[model samples]
Target: MLLSALLGVCLIPAHSKPAGEQLGSPLLQTCFEEAKKIVDDAYKYSREESLRRVRKEVVRPHDALRLLKQPRGGTRSAVRSADYMAQTLRLLQERVHHVHKRSLNVTDLLSEEDLNKLSEITGCASQVTFPSCRTTPNLNTYRTANSVCNNIKNPRLGSSNTPFARWLPAEYDDAISQPKGWDRTRRFNNFLLPTGYDVRQVSNNILSTTDAGVVNDREYTHMVTMFGQWNDHDLTFTPFSPSIRSFSNGINCDESCEKIEPCIPIPIPPGDPRLPTGRNSCIPAFRSAPVCGSGYSAFNFGGEPKKREQINALTAFLD
Candidate 1:
């Protein structure tokens, strides 16, 4: 259990993503050794082994303090590494208590097959090995190379925004890309605006042909980025924040809606065919208000009517 849990702390294959981090430190090595004896055949079922080895190795409060105060505190990576170490240590101790109460046998805790496989992968020389073809029957990589999604740690410490550039390309990117024609009349609208960025960069911006809207409401919205880097508009001109930038008359939202400053309602009357088929009751678009708007932008990419028209179409999208 300790071995599996320890490996889980940072067990992504080296080839998957380049995180040259050592999850366990030299000081923590003794902890693993002591834990090993508790589950080993020599010390099985011995309460003395459980007390001297398990409790002394991982459960002690002083050991946690020692690991947390490692000299590598200056760097952010060091801090995160220390955190993972502390969390895993706490987990290990909790497992020890649970196991001690249950009095489960070592073999009972982990099957012999799982134990051996773990051993082969994390070899004695402190190296990890890729499973062979026979070892990984489920992985069919002959025609297509297997790819696993992972988060590669950013060695850059203190830079909070991009601290860890996440990666889920293997699963999500492919899935999103597969629906090629879905964007046109895909039946859903989205605005993705990210936060904690240089806010000043988007001031006095216009969004037209090359412009895109970002919408985030923590509900019924999306947190977007300029995935394609549309250069036509400045986001802050619209007073972009990490929140919703709805159509307003600069003074009042309701007053603006009355005049159609930037908004117009979708005409989805009762019995309208476009109102989702098979619904017993009539339902209009959007929960914010029974209104839609001409999503005008100061940053028109190419020309006035063309860019304005595009924004209107985007605003009209129901989803």
Candidate 2:
């Protein structure tokens, strides 16, 4: 069933417009052209900075905290490499997002080819696209650290830094990249989703433990919870965006309560036990880093608009 679903997704037509068709508004074309230059410059700078850091770390071993902290194994190295790539992709996404927002109306009119061109300009096409897996002598003997090339036929399946396989199609507020619940006015099934703070309050009311109601389990200890967490870490890890600042605006996520891209602050309700009851007192949070080229509607094989899907930093399969 899963294979069939995956194949179905893979087989969806690109739905590209005719080659002679007009791209879009002049403003949209201009935005994309400017974006291309910005993306190219950003990649060049990132590459140069990376090389400089490598050289510095190699020459001054004492300053190599990042290298020293890394575990001495192929798995750790592979995971670190994935982390670097994810970070780079996140930055690229931020840059493109900024450009898109500058002319949102025009951007919304962009076709699949326009988005594909943007992806290529940003170097995300190379990052998200899977490479051909080469079988090794030890292929069956050991599992990879990042779980890449695990399936000889499908190298990226179940791999770290890949998009989660969705059983159902994603539903976004914009029917494209914006997250569900992003717009408070947005409705699902004739009902509105409650705010995060309201849900927290309900949890506090029902799940909070009192001294009088403290119950002990005979069969299990705290180690069960600890082990569960450890096991869970091995299976999936969705990392938050590394930046604390919003991509759309320069506002620091910690200081702003706005539902800007990357910052999704939890508003505190009135008469809360701990937190203050104001917009400014909300808990700060960041959106998870997205899989490169996955969120945009234009990039997917399936012509349906794709919502932002978080990257699974660990293997989907048990490691």
Q: lDDT of all predictions, in order shown?
A: 0.25, 0.55
lDDT of 1 by residue, 1-319 (tens): 3343343222233343222222233213334433333223221222243245334635644234323322221122222222222222333334433435543322223334543432332221111112233443343433212111111132212121111222432221113211222123333235433321112223313332232465446754322445323321321011101101122212221122121211221222333323332322222111111000101111111112111111100111111
TM-score of 1: 0.15
Query: Per the 3 Å backbone cut-off, how many clashing residue pairs does candidate 2 have?
Result: 0
How far in Å is the alpha carbon of 218 misplaced in model 1? 37
Candidate 2's TM-score: 0.64
| Worst 10 contiguous positions by lDDT, candidate 1 | 290-299
Expressed as tens digits, the lDDT of each residue in 205-227 for candidate 2 is 88877799988999999999999
Q: Supply the global lDDT for candidate 1.
A: 0.25
C-alpha lDDT of candidate 2 relative to the true structure? 0.55
- Provide TM-scores for the models: 0.15, 0.64
